[model samples]
Target: MRTAWLAERRSRSPAAHKTMDKIVTLLAKELRIQPRQAQVTLELLDGGNTVPFIARYRKERTGSLDEEQIRQVEARAQYLRNLEKRRAEILQSVAGQGKLTPGLEQQLQQATKMQELEDLYLPYRPKKQTKARLARQKGLEPLAGCIVLQQDTKETPAALGAAFVDPGKDVPDAAAAWQGALWIVAEDIADEASLRALARKTLWDGARLTAELMTDERAGKDFLLYKEY
Candidate 1:
């Protein structure tokens, strides 16, 4: 792990987050230590010095850390910088909403895990209006919350949904009730940790990269315009 951090920091294409991550993974194998442990030593030591310098000058500082380890740490640091830049941009956009509470601010600040950060950002991220948004506008949020709380399984979701309907309030009938309930259902399904995990596994495992067909054939005929697979 330490070796990977070194390679990542010393990477020539420092902006390539994906490549840097891959190098870090590879370097861990050469160093025979987990990536997390390697990362800690890299953090404690100086980074300005080149790989050769660390291999020679700071050997004692790294507990006699070796040449390959230095390379890995450098690469991982570059990866970290790229991630920091992206996180900053995302936080800046969220901050603009004027809705950021202190707990949320702290969560956003210390978000080293990508999945956790995205979960925090999901509600704020740009999106199109769907059935859920429509239901919220229709004043059925209370009923939706009841179904989702899942505290009482026998509370009859459909009956509670029926009680919340008001055509005057813009919900015309049980159809609208179901519509509102459907939105909540879909949102809950999407947000559920287990469901999301299963979906991610299935999606990544089953998904394929397909190229866009060029309607403007002349414009994209060249190989340079071709997208990665």
Candidate 2:
């Protein structure tokens, strides 16, 4: 009944229809159900029907999905909707800042999780007053870029940075300019999403957690096995 009511009352735009189709396909794949089942279930849920109501009164419409199955679908649908909303907002924010490139837009569109979206946006997000921002303000960003490019150059680090040293810019000497440039490079490396993701995966896959003994022998007698862990 609610599904029929939804069909009668709702009129979605083509973009909204596309979003719904994507949601349906994702739901079907994740929940291991047929596309028709996922579609009907999402429609019924959107019509303000409860889990028990769908499991009981709308069994036929839901393709006999149990209450647990409907609940999982509801949860996944909410997450996916939130993800899409956030993706749109991030895109708009970056575009407003004139930093959205075609590749970046594609990456944002392809992000499946909240973490992925946040990681991709890390470099563009408003940052605090950090060394990198300070260095950029002092006109040391070009030096930082040159260092990052790692091109073959006859000039040594000190010689390269010597050109940027200016008392008016607060860079007292080549050493100071090099320091600020290194700070900027460090922050750039930290903000890179791909490097961060790779490092995180490497750590998680190979890292170990161990408990160390920090108390006296008498106090730690109960967990002697973990003393050397």
Candidate 3:
């Protein structure tokens, strides 16, 4: 079993040195420790030393970081390792779909957080039948492009949409075509990474939380304090 496990570990893909460097730098900065300390801590972690064991027995190696600090280092290392794995998977999937442009590849490579990477990948991800897909299927993508450009101030939106109406595509009139185009635009805006990041920050900064009692009678009052909050 040990031999097989060793072989499996050896066969696993190695993460890039650049990613490890970034993680070490982040650990040093966030933990307010020396770079050598962070590097030694990661080595200990990779050697199967638990946080408690490292804190208790490996004081000289880790510069006497406490258990809590050792644990934080372990957690952050694991998070960055997982982030690198996810980044590779996303790149492979996008490349497979032939939609991976140079700019997009660069963005994926530079993304530091899982949420940022996921937001960038949203538009490229495959989905089931959605409003955007339905609109594209009905040949309304041209109208959608026109709406996105917004360059033709002389032509009304309805007039621009009227040109795409085809009986075979089930577009009965300009209004239906325009609606479908709007749906496509909405999906595009929702998938935009910058817009999503901005919206998330806005909500995080401004949103408030509230709790309410399930009923007037409190059979179990364990959560009674939460009702008033």
Query: What TM-score does candidate 1 reach?
Result: 0.51
Error of 2 at 118 (Å): 0.8
Q: What tens-digit string does per-residue lDDT give for candidate 2 at 57-174?
A: 9988888999999999999999999998899889999999999999999999999999999999999998889988999999999999998898899989889999999999899999
Runs with alpha carbons beyond 4 Å of true place in candidate 3 = 1-18, 209-229
User: After superposition, which runs of candidate 2 have C-alpha atoms over 4 Å from their true positions?
Assistant: 1-14, 217-229
Error of 2 at 126 (Å): 1.2
What lDDT is obtained when candidate 3 is compared to the true structure?
0.87
Worst 10 residues of 1 by lDDT: 39-48
Highest lDDT among the candidates is held by which one? Answer: 2
CA lDDT for candidate 2 = 0.91
Best by TM-score: 2
Expressed as tens digits, the lDDT of each residue in 135-212 for candidate 1 is 877887777676567677655756666787788878877668867877877786775544776788899999887777
Every candidate's CA RMSD: 10.1, 2.7, 3.4
lDDT of 3 by residue, 43-99 (tens): 777767788889999999899999999989999889988998899999999999999
Candidate 2 residue pairs in clash (backbone atoms < 3 Å):
none
